[model samples]
Target chain A: MKKRTILGVRACTWVWLIMMGLTLVTYLIGQLGLGGISASLTVLAFALIKGQMLGDYFMGLKRISGFWRWPVVIWLFLPGGLISVAFTLVG
Target chain B: MQAQAVAEPIRYPPGDLAIWVFILAELAAFGAFFGAYAFTRMQHVELFNHFQATLDRDAALINTFALITSSYFVVRAVASIRDNNSQGCVRWLMAALVMGALFLIVKAQEYAHHIDEGIRLSTNTFYMFYLSLTFFHFMHVIMGMVILAAVAVKAKRGGYSATEHTGVETGASYWHMVDLVWLILFPLVYVMK
Candidate 1:
């Protein structure tokens, strides 16, 4: 149990670090004033990945099974897809 | 050798099942709002782009980092409770609370800047969405923090154990959702052109 706890903590810490780095990258991309289709797509993709990491790892959804698994994926892709489409239309 | 009990598939939906329903409803609301924002943006592309420039991207970025870190700390708190480390869990939850507070502070500053600039929900379509969406999310952050504080207080009283700590996971789930919403919100509003 102790070993598992230690490993879990380590894994979470690593995930946190990765998320922080990705956020910095996202910030840089946004600050560069990336506009239009490609830019929106790129940022939205990053957002999707980041949101997935949080839901799957941080929320521990990855460890579970059954119908619970799909909501996170749906949540990410649905609004994300809609927003992406919206950006494309406007961009 | 004793036969091992047959393994069963894990149940769907984590935490309280009720929370999933609430989460779905909340997502739907936000989705509708995002769609509306996008539709409105399409109608007034020039105006949306123009006002988007006036937003403090830097502050939004800081708030983003804050929420992400808060979610991470919530993960740690849940992990600690799963290990029956009540004190450790409390510490992590408190740390997360600090991050949540930091998020609110930064958001407040952004709001102050906007208010000083005569921004309000009635300002325009863009400002309308900006203020409504962000402030609605801002309130969620506060609510998430309150939930964390309650969980932390309970943990401090040794209200959980290794075999039973659903509250921690429940609070963490909500916090993660809050973080997740911002992940979409930031790009859609602050970054997407």
Candidate 2:
């Protein structure tokens, strides 16, 4: 296999493991009665981490053409801003 | 002259633009639904918080694991197809399908339990949104399975190659989208007390 392919596989495995681990952490935190802003931030952080991993590895955005990469970045960022605005207004 | 020039470049079919477009539209729809959920939760913060406490965290956590595992297999399926490992791709896709089915089954049981406890959709505004959003997600899971089954059948017939496996790629992308939405929804609905 090419070096890039090997790297891709390894990165994907790491992302998957990390995502699963984060889910467990989220559950443990939830069970501990961490349900206020702390829990919300924790969930958002996990989601962001997982989202970045999925985008970079699974979606192959990291290897995408330059023309496509910026659009994806914009798509990902827009949601964060929107969610933040929603939370600020509501929370 | 030397060994002469190369012939015409081999042309592959277009990439999976159709599937990407579908995913974009689906994301937009989910965005609208999420915005609505956020807005409503803002309005009824106390009621929403109360409903959040009633959710089974363990069940939600299990479902999160299931979806994430399915997504991992989906990424594997795409990689296998790229390597021209048709059988491996089929195996991964099948695993994803099974996980999707398990998620739905668990969701059904949870719903049944809620209904038995007299927690119908009309119970409250919070319940209304909860049932509606989750049922919509459930439908997406069913659709994703159908797409995966189709891809699995094609893979079994050796229909995809390293150069022309757009179908598998597109199906996997859709499956990931479903998983992504659930990632957001799980925390928003179940953990955001």
Candidate 3:
């Protein structure tokens, strides 16, 4: 497969805008005092979205083989599960 | 070039796999810490909430942005090397290093502010975990900067090419891993009110 050149400024601008939007949503959610479950969920959602962006664009994992990709996706979930279990057992 | 003729069914470099395994092991260690943090938080939700309120969310947010943007530049560095743009590659790597340094400086400022507010690592279990985990993450950021600096030096010396930029690729991969860890850490530490 022919490798594509690095993204130009326009594409980077779009990505930056999307990321900023997510960050803003996160800030607004925090400010609204949404309590534990909702706030946690919102944060987790934003983290996952941001993680996907980082993985696909910043890490260039999108072009890698599945053998390399699957493990990373799985690794990302370990913390999420562990944190949820902790919350369930303790909270 | 002659090595390619042996035709040993080219595998993803063992060195890269070894690094991935090491990264996975680190993830497990961090998992244990997260588990502990969650368990303690469950037992003392109010205390954790109070502690969260004390955290500098704005600074954390800024640091998050910095790291994520740095990750983007690291990716660009890798791509530029593949395009045989050595100067471009060096420039991006330097940008990444600068951004990573900015994150550490902001983090230090946040730490100072926290200490001034009487929230030392020993303040409570929550603060203990918060300080330990973040400080640990900070160490990774420092290590990443070192790696990027090395890559920048190599790029400046024309040490990479379209087919042999594995060093740049691996360095960028490691830096991205640092960013990935912080993505989760930021939400858990700052937004979990």
Which portions of model 1 miss their true places by more than 4 Å?
A2-9, B2-7
lDDT of each residue in B1-193, candidate 1, tens digit only: 9989987777754477777788878878887888788878989888998999898889888889999998988888888888889999999999999999999999999999898988888889999999999999999899889989999999999999998988888888888999989988998888878
Q: Model 3, B13-129: lDDT tens per residue?
A: 222566667676776776677767877788788888887888888888889889878887887788788889999999999998989999999999998888888787788988999
Q: Residue A8 in candidate 3 has what lDDT?
A: 46
- Judged by DockQ cut-offs, the docking class of candidate 2 is acceptable
Model 3: lDDT equals 0.78
Against the native chain B, each candidate's TM-score is: 0.96, 0.90, 0.90
Indicate the worst ten consecutive residues by lDDT in candidate 2 chain B.
Answer: B6-15
Candidate models: Cα lDDT each: 0.85, 0.78, 0.78
Model 1 chain B weakest 10-residue run by lDDT: B7-16
RMSD of each: 2.0, 4.1, 4.5
DockQ of each: 0.71, 0.41, 0.42
Residue-wise lDDT of candidate 2 within B155-188, one digit each (tens)?
A: 9999998989989888887888788778777877
By the TM-score metric, which is better: model 1 or model 2?
Answer: 1
Q: Looking at model 2 chain A, which ten-residue stretch has the lowest summed lDDT?
A: A1-10
Indicate whether candidate 1 or candidate 2 has the larger lDDT.
1
